[model samples]
Target: MILPEIKREGERYFLSSFKLPDKLTFAGQPIPLDNWQVRERIEYEFYQFLEDQGESIILAKRTGRCFPPAEKQLADAGLPDDLKYMLLVESKCVAAAYSKAKASGPWQFIPSTGRRYRLKSDAVRDDRRNLEMSTEAAVKYLRYLKDFEQNDWFMAMASYNAGEERVRRLLKDQNITDYWKMHGPRETMRYVPRIIAAKEIYSQPEKYLGLSKKDLYMPMETETVTVNVKDSKRALASIAEEFGTYFLELKMLNPEFKKDVLPRGTYQMKVPRQTCPSRCFKQDKTP
Candidate 1:
């Protein structure tokens, strides 16, 4: 589908004075304009709800964690730097965060979508909530969307929030290619802006919002240990005592363990950087 340029009239909106194809399809599926109405309405309402909740502050806190690796991933995917802030809104930078919709990890990917991206979600190990693993998957998915949707970051992100099929249909119905000009639902309209607001706060935290410099959560540095134990809690307790640190610290460091139990097999456990020097796991007993 070809999108028309949008223009603003005196206190009103007008579609670009161009004609477009009547039908559009993405990935071989027909974009149903009628079905997109529900999605558009819901998206708009969600955007308004976030706006009323002081989205700027939430975005600021979320974007502060765009470290070099994540930044590089965004660049490699051909996505805008502002798109990184979507992670803040989606999962609050918490790798272990899960949604009521069963979306898990920093990207809040659903089980099916996670599987499509090759993110393992099994009884023994859920890579959806693993920081490094999930981030890698997210980058792959983003790159796929960008490639499929003409490299428009807005469409790519909208496709991320709403399914790619849905966004494609909206673009077809609106006869609009530019995300800012496309009229469908409220959420799509505000989705990009919320992300932009988040980027703004992240780029200049003190200027955009009143966040404490010292209170920022810095990323933790740790070493991974391969353990054969089935129960991570027991192993953590044993190791913590050996290292003279609390079990809670170990738990915090390894958020992938959903039930405080590592699945039976070889599991990757993260230990503090300082603990590596002491060889905490090799010690005999808890301190």
Candidate 2:
């Protein structure tokens, strides 16, 4: 077997001589590589991943940790397990991620789209940063898009980055159904390909990014607590202290607390797991 080759200059080592995998699919839908453009676009995405090896490696490390809940939710919904890669491509697994377009959270939902998916985002609270809620909303949106696009997952994915109307227009006006064959805005064009490339690299981190299984960051299980706040920050602090976790650490767990406070009204949030050493550390008296 001929292994992929790598070469190093004084400053940089480049990955090359790696043939594209014999087969690539996204969301259980086979990528139509028979089309030269489809093959090129997907291969272009592969090289793009290789080009940002450091960042891609970091994202790969994170994917293991971030993907479990997504996989679980999709599995529960009977959706494709591979859709988790789309989350990674969207925000690199950062729950509090924000884009200049005002898209927020791990799923990178803009306000209107977030609202369409029943995600609330405002000055006081943004469920977009709530990992579980955002993932659930995204799954619903993707499911709807796929169904709208006649069960073509890639087209649905492109529709996600673009929008349903634009995708519909392209499909109708261009007299074509294939994403690779249609002309879309640059960002939308690159979206699904990036997702596909991410799935490939993350699935074979050892082969692609040279990361070992042990190096992968897996999700840390956490417990949830529902707390209601009315008085002030003191109320939340008290809850955190009771859980044997610091307020700052609690905020890390729940970034939806834009001001270190819970969303208005009844909302259940993940607090701290006393069983987990990392989550249940003693508070510093000095502070």
Candidate 3:
């Protein structure tokens, strides 16, 4: 059988010649793999796995869309770079994303968990889904779990996903502390690998992944804008229009605001770095 030739180009390596894998079968079912479908499926899954391995790099490139501030906050909080990918895996960096179980945000904190972490969830606001607040809360909880698990990030991460109590029980029952050696649900098994994948991709973007420089969105610089606009969505739209930009740009900048409204009291707004210096105000200065 003729094998595909692997060639290196600049920082990236490609398989010049290759053979498609034999059709996979499970039970009595034969998997379908039409030409275009097979190519799309393989590319999708491959990139997904690549993003999982190198999430930091991938996420940083798409920072504007995915809450780049969270990444900076995590680093400032002294957390591992890999931990940033947890948010990516949980909510795809969308603060408003909600799960069927009521878990929400980048951290995927359930109501109980949010309460435990002192994240407020009321009519005025739901900190559980707030990117900044939830990120801080997640950092605190992860730190607590890390201490309890003896600084085992794997166990701490699993605890974050499955719950501390459950993780503790599993550890006790299995009489094991090594996450790699522990047996649990399939998700748990893939969780660490996913994180690792993201880290790898982020570290060496051009090496393992296929992304163009233009496709990568650089991190935007932003400052807090406290405007007393009851309807955040409308207010953001107004601001975007005032600035001659898109509303989605505003939404991307401020992910914590749930609903279409920014509640009463001062709300934080992030304007692009380019616009920040020109628009940001000091104590006595006006934008």
Candidate 4:
């Protein structure tokens, strides 16, 4: 999609006549657009997103493949549909995504956070890299934060970017009730506005960036099978050979397994059901 360009002068770039929508809502709650500070912050991020159209296109394309299942999961978990954009904002919906701070996966859970939420990260497996597991962990954490923040989704989202206790302390100490009003770290300050701008562009790609829903990449038709295995690596190789798929295909589909060996217990595997051969059966009996 061709994105709008920013014009520049001798010292600084500008979107001179560009302006944000008259009103905006995030996660079913209205952003206080009457506040010039709120409008300026969100507009700044929108300009930033426009400045990186190449990367934004990549993110939008990925959303096609990464969004559906997680969208369903979010709906099932009773989260607002717009919150799905958090995955995009967090890690660009990349399962292999890793940040400099050691946050990993689409949900960007740091090691300690992953452990607290039962997302195991070890030599053999980092559930933080697993889409399903990490997504559940994110939702669980969001829900907990929501409750703690007195059902305010904005506060929960801010705490997600910043530390929960830090935000809480700021809120209490400053006697501030609004997330936008509370002072926090730099990243936390920009986090919500970034997500809001992303959601706007993503949902209306054609309007904003000359791209349609057809440009999105949805997941392929696949099914998950439960199988008991002794060795992860060897078992995957065997399964790949049996199904006429590469080890990487299965590996990509199941990002939780970090080691070469598949574990001994029952594990769920996603396979392309239609394209897989009839002999591509679930492996309940291990050799």
Candidate 5:
């Protein structure tokens, strides 16, 4: 994953030549490759992805663990598979990732939007950090955006990055259904292209970097158990002890818990498979 060297003669750095595919489709919509501006923008981001070898390799590795469940969710929801790539562009698949805009998780959901999609954020827990919960919310939100934008995936995704209200106004004011033609904030403009670029590089990592199956991270196998802490707050260390594990292991599985002591509630928690003793076992769960 060595960084591609940029050539410099005196003051200017020369970018290495990289070519785009003759035909490209994003979210089943044909990219207007004939349009020079569109081609240039996508190619710019493509080269940006290619040159940043370290980031590309990390994304390649993360795909093994992060992409499967989300892709299955998208398929089950009847959404385009490419929509999963938004997670990569949004948070680079980091579960604990947070943005300056207060967006959090792999799907980069802000607090309000997370609530709208049934992802709760309280003092004890931020469900936005849970991959399954957040992905479910993202799938629902993207479906809403797609319907709102009249089945245009790019416009739907643009709305995902920029607020839907802003994209709605841009559509009406500009009178353009085509996302390529709309002029909005710089980040919104680049957002879809960045996802497209990510999709391209991720789809064919061997073309850009050296990687193997062993280098990629596989998802951990875990079992879920329900713990009801009725009318009393409990420290995570004590809870971990109940499962014959440690505080760090419990935290790794349940990053949503904000602190060591969680408020009284029934929690469905993940722990290493077979870690719980027979005395504690009642129902079996998988993750």
Candidate 6:
């Protein structure tokens, strides 16, 4: 099988050859590759993702850990499975990703939007940094956009990148509902295609990434538990000790917490299976 041409020069890698397939689809809608402008737009995004192998490879590794849950959420929400790629384009699956716009988490939701979606933020917790919570919010938000865009997934995705009001105004001004024909902000124009680019390259990673199964980063298997912190002054290190885990491991498992000290709340946490006894842990079935 022929692969996308890749060449390494010193420390950098370049994609020397890439061809647009005759057909491509995003969120179950067929991409108009026959249109020269659309083809070029797609090519631009392809290069944006593939030209640097380091970022591309890191993204591929992250996809393994991040995509499955989001994909499942999309499926459950009855949305297109391909919609998960939006997260990849939004934050490259970085849980701690924070934008200058203050969009946080792999879903890249700003504080106001995050709160609107029921992703609460407090001194002790930011649900935007919690992968599961943020993904759930993203699914609901996309569903709303999909309905608002009159079931057009492309326009829905565009609305996700650009505000819905702007997309609505663009549709009214341009008198077109077609995402391809309607002109919008430059970044908004590129956003959907970037997501499509991620889908294409990641769907068959070996074609672009040349990575084996072992090369990908797998999600850690852990059991979810409910921990009640009765003392506001108790540090996470103390809690970690109670669970037979180190403070760092505890923090790594629950990235939502903003501080090392507990704030007297009932919190759900994840830990290695068998690390804590059943009496000490309350199994959470919330997924």
Cα error, residue 86 of model 6, in Å, equals 1.0
* Poorly placed runs, candidate 2 (over 4 Å): 1-13, 232-239, 261-267, 276-287
Candidate No. with top TM-score = 6
Regions more than 4 Å wrong, model 5: 1-17, 275-287
The TM-score obtained by model 2 is 0.86
4 or 5, greater by lDDT = 5
Cα RMSD of all models vs. native, in order, equals 10.9, 4.5, 9.8, 5.1, 5.3, 5.2
Candidate 6 residues 1-287, lDDT tens each? Answer: 33345653444444655666889987778999998889889888998787777889999988888888987988899988998888788888888889898888889999988999999998778899999999999999998998898999999988988889999999999898789998888989999889888899988888787887678888887788777878756798877766656789888878888898987778788876663344243333222
Q: Which of the numbered candidates is closest to the native, going by highest lDDT? A: 5
lDDT of 3 at 99: 91
lDDT tens per residue, model 1, 2-92:
3322233443322223112244333233334344653454334333433433554554554544344577776776655555667766776
The digit string of per-residue lDDT tens for model 3 on 1-287 reads 33223234654333322223446322122334445543344444435554343554456566444546566776887866557767766776767889998997778999998998898787656777667788888888878987888877867887787777887887789998766556777676566545544544444456554455666775565656556565523455766555434579777666655555554456656665444445433332343
Kindly report which residue pairs in candidate 2 clash with one another: none
Instruction: Please list all clashing residue pairs in model 6, or write none if there are none.
Output: none
Flag the better candidate by lDDT, 3 or 4: 4
Full candidate order by TM-score, most accurate first: 6, 5, 2, 4, 1, 3
Among residues 3 or more apart in sequence or in different chains, the pairs in candidate 5 whose N, CA or C atoms overlap within 3 Å are: none
What are the runs in model 3 whose C-alpha is more than 4 Å off? 1-48, 51-60, 63-71, 210-215, 229-246, 262-265, 273-287
Candidate 5 C-alpha lDDT tens digits along 1-287: 44456443454333354568889998899998899989888988988887776888899999988998898999999988988889889999998899999998889999899989999998888999999999999999998998888999999999999999999899899998789999999999999999998888787766555576777889887789788887678998988877756899889888888899878889999876664444343243222
Per-residue lDDT value at 26 in model 4: 86
The segments of candidate 6 whose C-alpha lies over 4 angstroms from its true place after superposition are 1-14, 275-287
Which parts of model 1 have CA positions greater than 4 angstroms off?
1-68, 75-79, 210-215, 230-235, 239-244, 275-287
lDDT score, candidate 6: 0.83
lDDT of 5 at 134: 94
